[model samples]
Target: MAKIKALKCKECGREYPVEPLHVCEFCFGPLEVEYDYDEIKKNISRDKIKKGPVSLWRYVDLLPVENPTVGLNAGFTPLVKAENLGKELGLNNLYIKDDSVNHPTLSFKDRVVAVALSKAKEFGFDTAACASTGNLANSVSALAASAGMNCYVFIPSNLETNKIIGSLVFNPVVVAVDGNYDDVNRLSSEVANEFGWAFVNINLRPFYSEGSKTLAFEVAEQLGWKTPDAVVAPLASGSLYTKIWKGFNEFKKVGILEENEKMPRMYGAQALGCSPIYKAFKEGRDWITPEKPDTIAKSIAIGNPADGPYAVKVTRESNGDMEVATNEEIIEGIKLLARTEGIFTETAGGTTIAVLKKFAEKGVFDKDEVVVAYITGNGYKTMEVLEGHLNKPIHIKPTLAEFKEKVVGQTINK
Candidate 1:
């Protein structure tokens, strides 16, 4: 039997049966999955999890599903000790939680889509769908294809060509909305109501968001069962940021880690184009105001983030903060990680890296603190953003002298 106990409203604390619901009928607040943690504690242990598969299912006892149907090898990505990147920023201990190489789809969305589709199947849904900016669409389409379910992916019309192609190759029904991500999400919400499809981030959201906890699980496990001093994650709907903090705390409650140490400070990153959460944090407000996104970080471009207030609260409670990155800084961040860590990540990651650097400059992170910055997507999916920015190939003749003049001479001069 699934360990899920109930669906609880995040605002008014009303609990309901585990069903295809995402909002409270009374207060109209978002709902979250309530698990039977006591039963989970009885079955889950470090030894038990270590013996399971290296995928997200390694923590299956903690996940909501009893029968996972997809992404058998997602999660458990490397927590790289970014010595070069750390040195560049004058920090002694910095790491990159590189989810850009997650299995099947090579993005963190694979983790969420895996669990969401599993829950969809458990609920007897024959179709799976989502309103995504890019990564989630790619993941949902690919996983649904593998599961033999009809898939529909809705996205803003201005999504990157490669991201659109990423979902198309999976042969799912693709819908391009006429406006931004918020517009696409609103339309998808209406479609979910009319068609009754298991829209992953809509009706199936309580289950879908649980997948992000695996990132935190892997990070703590990778660091020898201890939370890092700080974490920096990109904020889209702010779901990932909040879930990661929950994962660490859950581990402590289950006796997997010590609670005596200070909780990891949770920092959030956002592109200046859509920085509602950051703005709220900066103004010391408990609420967020939406913005019209206009940035290259399309993957994290949710103008009205659903969990923006919660993200702000989490950051403040953890004694952390949020920061924004400009397009120029974001591009520079992408190049810095590539040159330093050989990890090519998407604009969301660039935003994360840029904000991390800003924090380092502001003395937000102590020099010896263990900091982990998450890189959520592969840069290959957004190569168009680097068209004129990256160095082009040097044209030269076949002759050795010509090669020397064009290539070797340039190298020598540099």
Candidate 2:
């Protein structure tokens, strides 16, 4: 009668009880939440989802939680049609699943933290913590504040100024490690073990990662109960990308989607500076080779992604591909989306858009195929990346003549 069956290892198929564990002792592989799809199929239906709350909790039956009490207002972000962006990309059906305005943190991290913290409360934890690149720190700090739990966030010392301030504003204990994300993660693991606190990405990762499936659930429900033809998402630890693949498949498995509907071709996007997954995919390898982080897209600059192999597996099995974009291309991608669709996204989203453009140019997507590009974080948190790239504001005297001569005149001259 339980909602979930057990925590099963992805490699050895070993199972453990529902607890704060993420690894299998037998194979040293990652563990995932196993559910009863037959029971879920009997309970979930289209009519039930339509009548549920507007947040991600609408798919609570699919997630790894019970009696959710955190992030009540999170999820249910807009799936914009993106007509202007679609025209520029030469694709007829392009949608932008914008999580830039996600509740509390303005990033998709809120989704995972929401589920993680809620489950942490259920497990009677008084503190919520995480190792973050940027957005996850903000999410944990803000959401933990809302849940009235003591919060600690660890991040690289060189993270963006705005992101640091974002977490500080929530009054959490923020630690800045003198290294990249992987290094910070190593230290956080030690801290989690010592403190016995609920490290969202460490001990509660199975529940945390399950939250990302809501993005796919919302996308399907918004698209009239159908899946997109293709999905291009930014990859960091690769959890989001792989979970989305799982989400769509789970929908089919639970009988939410029509029998004829198929999973989308999953495309993984990454910055050329830290593109381990991209390299692995290109080499046709089922494993990942770690790289050093050196890109403006810091949010997705994980040198050693924990879920890199699984992301590669999803892309291959779904007949998908991966691509990387240069720093210059990433900036242009941000500018293009802003100009075309009026969405200001961070470098991670920029990387995704740049790769989407490349795939469009290569004629990878059919003209009528429905493609969705996920914009995960708001650009305001990463404004420094666009400092010298964006056009400067024109200055003039406070007069109508000056406005016409400087602004209107320049526009007409062009």
What are the Cα lDDT values of the candidates? Answer: 0.92, 0.94
Q: Which stretches of candidate 1 lie over 4 Å from their true place?
A: none
lDDT of 1: 0.92
* Candidate 1 residue pairs in clash (backbone atoms < 3 Å): none
Residue-level lDDT tens digits of model 1 in 87-109: 99988989999999998898999
Question: Residue 412 CA error for candidate 2 (Å)?
Answer: 2.7
Per-residue lDDT of model 2, residues 78-97, tens digit only: 99999998998899999999
lDDT of 1 at 358: 96
